[model samples]
Target chain A: MSENSGSTSTNIFVAKLSSYIDLSIEEHQVIEELTQNSMAFDEGQDIIFESEKNSSAYLLQSGWAIRYKIVPDGGRQIISYLLPGDIFGFRESLFELSDDSVQALTPVIVHCIPAENIAEICDSHTNLSLAFTWARAREQAILTEHIVRLGRRNAYERLGHLLLELLHRLQLVEKAGNSDYFLPLTQEVLADTLGLSIVHVNRTLRKLRNDLMIELDPKTRRLRILDVDALSEATGYDQSFLDQNEKPSRSPQDAIGFEEK
Target chain B: MSENSGSTSTNIFVAKLSSYIDLSIEEHQVIEELTQNSMAFDEGQDIIFESEKNSSAYLLQSGWAIRYKIVPDGGRQIISYLLPGDIFGFRESLFELSDDSVQALTPVIVHCIPAENIAEICDSHTNLSLAFTWARAREQAILTEHIVRLGRRNAYERLGHLLLELLHRLQLVEKAGNSDYFLPLTQEVLADTLGLSIVHVNRTLRKLRNDLMIELDPKTRRLRILDVDALSEATGYDQSFLDQNEKPSRSPQDAIGFEEK
Candidate 1:
């Protein structure tokens, strides 16, 4: 692994996983090796297509992507965001075909870990395996939140809730400041994600700005949640699902209790 | 395990998992023991409440449930349905608290597998562990589809798509016949699930019946999709995500290949 790539690509991952469990030097080395080789996709390019037989799981080293599907009428539903330090393709390992396609919303870089390597890693590295499980659970929680966002929330709550989520998720990987992140999404993208029209998304953004809930710089594509606690209270955005309080043990032998040994 | 409960409960799970990979006699026994002791909940009872510290994963032995969350405005959003043979709560193992609450839609029975037992089982039993992983992947796929349903599809498509999904998922565990099942859900439940109002859901169901796409008997609480192919095509309901075609190898030693030994 080149020292430059190792420091850049693997840092986001190590930062994310370190919150769950303290990694040993060997574990850190394994992650660095796993993410050394990388591939890049330009903005608007398809990273992984739907129904494809993908044999490897990918680690998103940098940039932004979306996992999405198209309805019969050609309407797209953005399933979830694939941010830095996020893992993908692994979920497709046991499936016959990929359900949703992933696309790069911005210039994106990733490291592919073949299925065999994933299985081997999980079998040998208990700490890494547990971290993967934790990641999956976190992803599920986010999807559940998204479902609720679309199913119940109005345009304003939906937009605010989503921004809050991005801010917190990006903050975890040091991709954002205390309450701001580089949000390279078009109003159309936000519309597709929030189940609204572009006009509606635009109106909602204006309302949020007028209401002092958020600030979005169109040129820089950066968003800042001015009052996160108030917006969270107004929108029912709970960060507890994304935050881990107790450090789980690295091995199954010591996982019985909820404390790190 | 009593022979009667064993035949009914474990059979569904065995039937579901058997479609993915053939289980050894010992694996069947393990499932049987895991489900032998179960707790029952009456209709309208909370199976697992939101924010509850859950220490055990659950196996749904019989009846139906819904995983849902309430918005700040008291609006409820049903995230996903928990059917017989479905395993849950394990997803909560890594999270500090449950993100959503699970409620019994009918008189429900579930077996609790403690967190420690889950860790030990996955550590020792590679096949069962893989099966769990497969189940998690399938659940994630379902959630992804739900997001698409909510975000992209109209009321007609959403209602139709969800019914097709339930039909296929229920059929996987022998809980449904060729094209019909006992659907014990009210219009309110349907409204919460499909992101529509009760009046809208009722109107849509009537429209579906009028169009000869479905037959829902209110008296018996049974639903029959007259032509699944037509409905699926119309609603963009793809069963490929729920259906398993490839039998993955049970052991990681042999998982490198696609086919089962």
Candidate 2:
């Protein structure tokens, strides 16, 4: 998707921020200056480099991306996935250059806000600073849950949890239907995210399909959750975390420019 | 360490919170009420339980603790370790009954402040609310780092990262010397934390020992990092995330209560 084609005139990012706290006209102007002319990435592109110093943070407009680290043995572990309206690459940049890389999992659009602007915002606006803190804390909670999944849950349970989480997040920005959502992921990509072998991922997918738990149509890139209750039970995921009352202003389609791909 | 020890008479909890924001006399009195008659736990005692509702957030007065979750198959994953003056179990309680457990890794004292009191403070004191937000965000950042470590890094790298993190945290609370820290963990516990087998943990520890990266005296429960540069190089850990400048008034030792154990 071309970034310019999907760019909204409504200042959805500012609108999103307003949901947390009211911003003055001057502060909004400052944010616009901070975000103006930020670059965007195509699907499967690298946004941040591993082991490189970073001076900016990206706000997701549309599509999906992942923050991950590569091991010496050529293994990749996806630490977290960024969805529409999600902000990433800031926590690392806030301290120093990130040790991990963020890659676009789908055709993605992002607002490249300068790190200096973020620091300024934190210094000037206590509310914005608190919002940033809330965002980071939520990120940490997700990671802790992931640790539990990786450390304790089996492959099937982990996959179930991942699906439930994605669906819930999609619902947050109104991207998901009542019982379904589009999951723009390949088996290989899923393997990387879930820390499973491709074969294992394929097997689990088949099992899920056979049990009428989920239906994925690769041709249309649509995911139909046939048994969400069962899946949630298996995953032990409660939707409360996903229903955090914070929503980004842009639609998932607008955020990712999914149609352009 | 008994809860009624003379040294524990001075409330480190209030002092720690004041580091984030200057609490008023009334606010200090409120905090004292919340923490009244809190108990201490010996090493290996559970602070909060899985599937139980805990109304209080703990301020670590002394020693170490861990937040962990258990799987149906009985495997455990230690999500994050709590140091002196660190708070845990409150955020989870804010939403629902606790979904995980907190346990003492060492004999520890903690001031149990009711979650309701904190919520009241946040509602009244904007600065305190901001401080709470920052604390939560910091916790999230740590969890995100752990996800990257466990999902991507090798056993040795994971071990290195874990040790560096523990030592860095210990140093923050002044529990450790300049270059050395006491790690009161066994190979089995380390294996569980790293999601590796005990055999793998032992082999990795031996490799690290042989490489002159670290020296572990299991008998003395002491860990001497021989080469900080090599350790950071191996773990990709940057120390900036450990910054506590916002609350510099509270000594890492006093705020975190490293001496309480």
Candidate 3:
């Protein structure tokens, strides 16, 4: 375990969790104790292994990660991407054991919370229990939406939906900047996440760029949405799911600048 | 609308709701009034259209249903499935309006609970509120699992896992018999649910049958698991998730012949 070498301990992730429900000073002290010493992983590092006896949940302090599973016959599926402030591996540990694994997508910093302490916290605080329930429910909702995307949507729609979802979640943690967001994803990872071939993902991305809907700068890892409306129309993602309180700035017509497919 | 015929009024679906939380005589009277006349749909009938302004939630009195959305390119993705004693279309009324449609997958009888009445009930009973919260969380969990399935697993594994999931949910209502369960689904629907082509589904089903794992009697809509061990291995479904207590079963091996894939 290594200490996080940063000046900001009270970052957006911590701030967001506190907004949902307050923690007393003693509770904060416990949280510090739980995550006083944490680990950092470079890109593409596996944090949680499939069918492993994992007993800790992680709080994403910085960078990105993904939870996924590998199937027989050498196929890989990226279940979901975990952004800063997102909680991962909690649901899997709630029952029997983890059936999937978590991998770092970028140089990631994580605050590890022991499962036993989480259980104790839930027992003591009703609000914490409610928060845990909400967090799990939200995680499930994301999974459900992913099922829809994988099972039904086309590659173009899937990519568009994926971008919109990332943007929405990023906005929740105040990481999104205007229509542009930092997307530290490689084409290979995108293909794995969307269950498409790398060649296919590249072709589709070219198409999206040609349509003037989005711009991706691989070197800078910046994704700029030129037309949110066009993207939303293509993806069928209503920004209402982004945050219950924050209304979308641009209308569907103005956002994407393209006709709904 | 037609009245709940004969003793079906005392069905598990109706009884389970009241068991979780108290309903006053008036509340019970209201429930009776709401369900006194309800509608039944055969398999594959659309029960709730996407984005419709219906302010009623359907209670599953019998059979199964699926909530889903159709993509622009004629692809259908099933978001979640509703089993007997399950409720659907309630979140639309509770939160914002729904963005998805729901359809019956088997001959289903449903009692429509009005949104206004549900709100009144929630305001009156704290237990009902908690139960409602739990219900929503559970629904979200199902969706999350769907996401994981869609984002990660392969066609064969997805299909097997989906079948196992349906079987487990059906067992809760005692609708599953031995190794056989009624599955009124076509290859097209299965393809949509699993994010595969109908041809692929057919091929996968044949593979399972050839492996001496499962047999599907299409004419009778009956599915027979020939080898529970093989089936579980193919699906990677843990029987513990099916336990009603939300805890893994004590004797998981006896509960089901599940072997991780």
Best by DockQ: 1
- In model 3, the Cα lDDT at residue A101 comes to 79
lDDT per residue as tens, model 3, A1-261: 346644546654445655544445444555556556567888888888876777677888788999876665566778788998887766654443235678888888887778767656754544444455445545655665677778777899889999988987887788898788999888888998898889999999999999999999988989998999889998876655433321111122322221111
Off by over 4 Å in 2: A1-40, A46-59, A72-74, A89-94, A111-134, A210-212, A233-261, B1-39, B51-57, B85-90, B93-98, B112-138, B198-218, B225-261
- Measured with C-alpha atoms, the lDDT of residue B164 in candidate 1 is 92
Check candidate 3 and list the clashing pairs.
A140-B144, A143-B147, A144-B143, A227-A255, A227-A256, A228-A255, A228-A256, A229-A255, A229-A256, A230-A256
CA-based DockQ, model 3:
0.31
For candidate 2, write residues B1-261 as lDDT tens digits: 345533446565566666555555655666666556557899899888876766676777778888887765678888888888787766753444236788899888787767657655755554455455556656766776777677667788889988998888776556789789888888988888888889999999999999999998989989999999889988776665555543322113323222222
| Candidate 1 lDDT, B92-174, residue by residue in tens | 86567456899999988888889889988888777788888988998898999999899988999999999999999888777
Against the true structure, what is each candidate's TM-score? 0.93, 0.72, 0.72
lDDT per residue (tens digit) for residues B50-70 in model 3: 766676777788877888877
Model 1 C-alpha lDDT per residue in residues A170-233, reported as the tens digit of each score: 8878899998889999999999999999999999999999999989999999888899999999
Better of 1 and 3 by lDDT: 1
Model 3: residues with Cα > 4 Å off, grouped in runs: A1-9, A17-39, A117-128, A245-261, B1-61, B73-75, B85-98, B107-161, B168-173, B197-214, B227-261
- Greater-TM-score candidate between 1 and 3: 1
Clashing pairs in model 1?
A: none
Question: What is the CAPRI rating of model 3's predicted complex?
Answer: acceptable
